[model samples]
Target: MIYFLRNVDDKITQTNFRKALTIGEISGNVLMDLSVMADEVIGPLLCNPENQKGWPKIVQNDMKRHVNELRNLMHQLKGEMSSQIMLPMPEGVENIYHAEARLKESDSEDVDLYLKTNIEGAIIKWAQQIYDLLQEDSYIAFKRTKFPLPISDIEFYTHRLRNLEGIYSQLRDPRVKRMAHYLESTRSVYLACFKSMLTNVVAALLREVCNLVIQQCTNSVDPMSIFQGDADEQLIKLRKAMGVLNHFIDTYEMNRDKVHTFFPPGVMPVRWSFDFDRVFMRFNTFMKRLKMIDNIVEATVEILKLEKVEFSGLRGKILSTECIKVLEEYTLIYQNLGNITYDPADPEDTRFLSDYDKHMAVLEDVDRRLASLFSQGLDECHDLEHFFKFFQIIGDLYHRPIIKNELKPKVAKLLDFMHSNLDAVKEIFDEEMAKLNPKGVERPMVDPYLPPYDMNRLNRAISWYNAIREGSHETEVALIEKEISAIDHLLGRGVEELTWNDDFTEWMAEVYAAINTLQERVLTAQNNVRRGLSNIAAWGDKPLHNRKDNPEKLELLAVNERHPRLVARRNKILQSHAEFLHILKDNYKLFFNIKEDEESDDEEEELEEVDESTMDEDERLARAQKLQAIMEQWEAKRIAREERERERAEIAQAKFERREARRLKREAKEAEKRERQARRDEG
Candidate 1:
């Protein structure tokens, strides 16, 4: 180290280096004394001066070796010193921010100054990283890292801050000033983040306490059932929340100083918008109000002269009908309480409110809950039974003296719907009674064996009246519920109930007598037809026993002119059967669920090819008239089709004749031209 030092001193003291250091550069040779520029000096051997010294070869070789060693040592010293300017960053990691170097008080002034000069680039890079990260994460990253800060020691506080203190440059050049600009901006951002985090901590506590208040109020459950929260768990949550808040306040007081020490003067606020006192006061107010509600509830039980009240929730919510009863009693008290005697002389004594005012306040709060619940509840009522019951319970409460005036319109609205349904049921009952199928001369035959009344429609009305009968709604609503039920018992029994009525029984008896007479006649006719159809094949009809006889369609019997009496007997049987079927069709109408096929007559006649010779005059004349009309229609259609075809042929012939004339004329023109050309050629 001494040898390197001696050589560096020796080289700087050379004549040319001395001249450059003292005399720098001179323009016009006048400012040689004032110029600050320095020029580099060349060695004599490189310049090859004319009068340079000529040393021995061994001596020159020794000087060159030591000079090369001195140069290498100086270069190594520069590399070592420059690397310490920034902290030793982990490999592959960008040197954004890290632990500050352990700068010692014993560091020489020049050493400190040298390090300060080299630190500008590192500080600039770190500031740029903070700026970009803050912008990218919208300062959320900084808040997570540095805000709501822990009670860390001074060592943790000092991390990444050494370069920003007083060590960095404050120059006008952008390179140096740019570092200061960014760092100053970053400090402002950090200060804001610290304030926001501290304030947010208190805000979160206040919000939690406010939520406890709401949960306490939302615990009410009554006829309206505005809130149905679990009571026991809510009570536990209230105490737990208070305990947590007390513990948080104690912890904040304990760490108050530590927090201030962690963030020095500019990074922390002296006074904040939110504080420990404000959060604690909000919690304290909630507890006080809770006690007030307790007092009001106890007073209410005493005033109503009721049995020992059992509390279900913080709010005066009860599960049974007595809750509504208490509200009813409270209504009476509320009216008397309105005549409060305030001190006349001490008008400023408005500080004390009577128990009546407190009760009214609670009821007003409940009134708001009812209004909200009713608006949503009435819209959800779909069933008639439920609508009446709901109105009986909740609507009656709403119509109380205290709550009535405010909720009168809603009560009237629901009653309108109720009256409309009642009117509709009455209408349905009247319409269905009119369908009794009265025993008159015309249209007396109802669906046979079915009830003369529309039992389904009558039962619908009966069931509706039953539904409305259960609940005691406030409004004066009466219906024919009892009368409708009696009518139902009489008429809606079953289809067989129709015979119990005298008019219907008499009509049914007459129908039965007529049907019995028709049945006797039909049996006689069928028996006669069957008896005549029997062929005495063993002896009476010996020809029918012939081996060659075929019964295919009975045509062989018809062809046997020798059996005229046989044909005549068969014809009489067929005619008699036809008369029997006609009698059945003309005399009776039945309760068939559907109509007979409308084309049955046409189809039967189509199949009635009963050897047209057998058809009587009436059937034969009708058939002949029908067949004649059909033939006339077909002949007229055929004539029209022939006329259309004839017209089309005439048009086609005219076209053909025109085409032939044009062809003949063109052929004549071609022949004449050919002859004229032949004559010209001969010439």
Candidate 2:
């Protein structure tokens, strides 16, 4: 069964290749036919003596008629040939108007020169290639290398032919114009016919190859399935073929560009020589080798699966052979091209080496460029994988990871959508909040729900929520709806809680009313206290301000011992009160745990002194004496403390200086020892 499947698959791939081969064959044959007909029959007829004699009379009608037929055929073939490949089709690939114009050269168009140069060789090969393409293993001679036919040469020819468009447009002669018109018509017909054939051939071949590969892969399960089975070979082959296909696609595009233009290049004939013939051959060889390797790999894989086939070194050996070698060889080839150097100071050397170095540099540059491209592709693949991993993470949040593996991407996409439009959600909430009103009545202005007790913790929670919402898990529509509903509910509650309303207005009003009442009472009481204090002065019955006389002069020569004593007592009390308030109020919470109620009691039980209105002369004298003593003691203590602090600082500085000196001395000794050791060694 496996053999049958593999055979069937191979047949399909071969069939498709054969179809492409046939298209190339048929197109090649038609060109050959036209050339032969033009050369042997048409040219001879037009040039013959007897025919020439009668030609002038019948020329107008007969020439047009004859040309029309050829034109029609050419167009048909060109059309047929273009439709085979799964790539962009360039303009006029099937058109031969340009080719015919070259032959007649009735006009001085440069395309005529290009066509004349190429037509003979082109026709000759076209005729020859039909049979060759039919051969099972025939290859074309491209750059001295015999690569597979159709695959190798066709693209190159297409490129050359398409590049001839520019030359085609400049022709002005009636005969050349007629020929162009005729060729175009024929090209269209040819293209249409060829495309159908190519499409069929390619489709059939790929189908066959895929089937064969699949079979080989399956068959490799049995150890004794095939005598020399190697499954790894199959995988390698598949990869190679895939690579070649990629290369071919690129080359095809390059050729297509040439074909799409009307006025392409005057020197197309010469430039065409540089067509990707080698690339195409390599591609073909790679394709064939890949398919063959894929078969081997698949077969071996199957065998290994069945009863432990001891196939080890046999696998990757062949796959690894040319890849590394090719990479290295290509690298060396580019490197030998030249080294690149540029210096602002060396103009002469720079000038001589510029172009050569530039070209060589391109070769070297391509290595990094290619490596970068490879890395970029890998990075893209990795990014895609990471995207999928993120999707899996999101999936884990909602559904089982294993089950949601396929849907993870979908969920991730949903999260991305939500995140992208999060502002919209905020906008909606803002609109909802704006609808609330606040006016009239007394109540607490402060909110009951405090700011999130911990901002960092809140922010972290928000981040987690945002991550969940923005993640890439394949969330079910229902689940997303539910989440959205939940968010809406929270948003609504948040808006209601935050928005100012009737209750908030009432609370604010009440607070303001109470504050106004307290403020009025405080102002009245302060006025009364000020008045009472103003009426009773420490200087006795007279107002204190009126009684004061030359206070500064009195301060300078104060002979009244009581006055000085009183001033000292006043200053000490003020200083102690200020210090006590500072020490208690600043970082007060760290001190004793005096509750608000206990604090009130303590304030009530604090000492009371005689009022300024009730002071006696003897009592004042006694108080002044006590104050003087206290002031002297405090002054002496303060001076002593300052002296101690200064001494301590000086000691610290001395210690630092001594340590530094010792370190310097030790360093000097080490240096001296090293110098002495060096001298001894020298001796």
- Candidate 2: regions farther than 4 A off: 1-180, 183-229, 250-296, 299-683
Model 1 CA lDDT for position 297:
39
Clashes of each: 0, 67
Compared to the true structure, candidate 2 yields what TM-score? Answer: 0.19
The sequence of per-residue lDDT tens digits that candidate 2 reaches over residues 144-208 is 47455665555644443342221122222343344335434334333333333333333333333
CA displacement after TM-score superposition, residue 491 of candidate 1 (Å): 95
| Top-TM-score candidate index | 2
lDDT measured at residue 417 in model 2 versus the true structure, 0 to 100: 51
| Model 1 agreement with the true structure over 1-683: per-residue lDDT tens digits | 01121223344655646443433234453323211211112223422334335866666545544443343344334434442112221111112122112222323211222223234333444345334322332234355567533433323323323322212222223343332333333342333333333344345445454545444433431101111223334334444544654576577567765565666668854433476554555555544544443344333433343233222222333332344555565656544543445421121333224553666576666555445444445445555665565555553345434445655555556667788889998997776666666673334234567755444544454444444344323221222334335434533432333333323443333333433433343344445444444532222454432333565655534454547656766666577667656644432322111124322322333323567888899988998898887667666656866886899799668746754655576577779999999999999
TM-score of 1: 0.17
